[model samples]
Target: MSSSDIFIGETIGTAILILLGGGVCAAVTLKASKARNAGWLAIAFGWGFAVMTAVYIAGPLSGAHLNPAVTVALAVKDGDWSNVPTYFAGEFLGAMIGAALVWVAYYGQFQAHLTDKEIVGGPGAQSTAAKSVEAQEKGAGPVLGVFSTGPEIRHTVQNLATEIIGTVVLLLAVLTQGLNDAGNGLGVLGGLITALVVVSIGLSLGGPTGYAINPARDLGPRIVHALLPLPNKGGSDWSYAWIPVVGPLIGGALAAGIYNVAFA
Candidate 1:
């Protein structure tokens, strides 16, 4: 594919991916949304559907490598780095755009959720409440989950390991199952199978660090969250940000190495 095609395809595809995926989080987390309290199953399935939809729409144009991890894995597998930067640029840009769209779609719900003194914590908070926010700030803000992933139990080693393992599973599926066809793009059956794989990963491994197997998926929205104007949204949790970015890249490379040795 041409650079323009790859860029536009990834940009549009990843935008849809993050829109629907993050939209689920906002729906379940925000107070006013009807899907509120829909639980983890809803999120897992929602993300799977999002991936399916994005892949089908963008596959023909750019092969729909919407995640940086996927792009890196494909590059490693094909020994082709020519378009990696274009793919990465589109992925991150699309992610930020999609996240902003989510904010726009759920502006009122965000206002309601964040402005609640109970959620934001303030001078009126009990000592325990203040302590709770303090602890959360170290990893993520209350509303940050809507934009990015964070660990449930903050252990650097465990959180990084979880991301790597989840990403390896995802990349393996993509590499072996013809989901992306070695960066050529996604086929219909391959897209569906890949989406199911994502859902499976989420259900089995998402509890730890929300299974951020895609670096752009986590970091792009986190950047948007830091920049966007939201009242009392709390810290962006910069401290825990590096793991999601680094772990997924490592996982992609590792998956590609394994594929080269065994599948190639």
Candidate 2:
């Protein structure tokens, strides 16, 4: 595919991904009436569906690299350093656009359901509100709240480890799926495998820190949450933000290293 085609496909695909992945977060967490806490299963399957749908739509044209780590991994695997900048830029831009749409699509619902007071409380309260809304909406038996970082801000090492492991699994799966195999085109089988990988990561390891396996996925949406005119939004939590970015970069690089040793 041409560079233009790749760019367009990646942008649209990433937009759809964040729309669905983050949309679910909003749907369950933000919407007051119909809100339902999207458990690990929901998050896992939502992302799985996001990947499946995005790949189905854009994989043929752009390889559907909605995640920056995947694009970086592909560049490293092929030894093509020149396009690295362009691909990363494309992925980042796409992720931002996608995240923006997710915020927009769910903004009204989020506002309607959640109070301004709830948003300003902190990330923990904001997340809790989301879970409460989701439970009420779905009429679920009981709301399941998953807390990672507390208000006091302890457990730096644990959070970093969580990010690292999450990113490692994400990149390892991409590498194993032959992202660079021009001859091995991605079909339904490839899509299914990718979906399963995402589900596995969420179920087994997403307990701490909501498994932000993609840097762009977290940072981009967090930016939207800050900039968007949400009534009671708390601080963007920018202080602790570097861990996700740095951890994922290291994890992706490490996964590449391991893949090279085992498969290359």
Candidate 3:
């Protein structure tokens, strides 16, 4: 594929990915309907499936780097560094746009469930309250709200370490499965690998802080959370944002190091 064609394919494929993956988050967390938490497992699987779909669609064209970490890892692995800048730009921009669409898709439900007055107690009390109310109203009754990485006021080292480890595992899986040519069509294997990685990270290390292993995934959606006129949206939680970026970058580099040593 030509450079332009590759860029466009990646952009569109990534946009679809974030739209579906992030959209599921909004649907479960922000939507006011009675079926709010009907599909936590489904949401997780949706993300895995989204990756599969995006890869199938754009892998041939631009390698389907929907995440910035993936782009960085590819650069590190192949040393084809010239396209790094372009790929990063496309992935991040596509993530931002996808996040915006998620906000739009769930805007009405969020507004209907959460009000301005309920969101103004302590730090992030608004988001907490909104999430609680959304659950109660939907009859899901106290579903955990979606996780977010907050300021580094507490457990900075632990959080960063968790992100690093989480991202290392994620990248390792992608390298072994995502970039592999298993001849028998590795799409399903790749999807399962991603799902298992996410589930493992969420179940084990997702206690104190949510795992934001992908920098673009966290920052892009956080940007939308800030810009969207949701009822009583809290601060974008910018303070803890850097860890996701730095941790993933470090983790991807580490994974590359390990892969090079072990496989190269």
Best by TM-score: 1
Please rank every candidate by lDDT, starting with the best. 1, 2, 3
Off by over 4 Å in 1: 122-132, 179-184
Q: Model 2: residues >4 Å from true position, as ranges?
A: 33-35, 116-154, 183-185
Supply candidate 2's per-residue lDDT for 139: 29
Enumerate residue pairs that collide in model 1: 63-185
Kindly list the per-residue Cα lDDT of model 3 for residues 1-264, writing each as its tens digit. 456755676677777777877766667665465557756465666666666676677666676666777777767887867776777777777777877777677667667655534432335565756654554443322212332344223577887888888888888878876463422223655655665777666566655556677777777666666666655454455666688788888888888778778876
lDDT of each: 0.91, 0.65, 0.65
**Each prediction's Cα RMSD?**
1.8, 6.3, 5.7
| Residues 184-260 of candidate 2: C-alpha lDDT, one tens digit per residue | 33667887788778878878777776777777776666665566665544445666667767677778778888888
Which one wins by lDDT: 1 or 2?
1
Candidate with more favorable, higher lDDT: 2 or 3: 2
lDDT of 2: 0.65
TM-score of 2: 0.82
TM-score for model 3? 0.79
Q: What number of backbone clashes does candidate 3 have, counting pairs of residues 3 or more apart or in separate chains?
A: 2
Candidate that would win on lDDT? 1
- Our model 2 lands, by Cα RMSD against the true structure, at 6.3
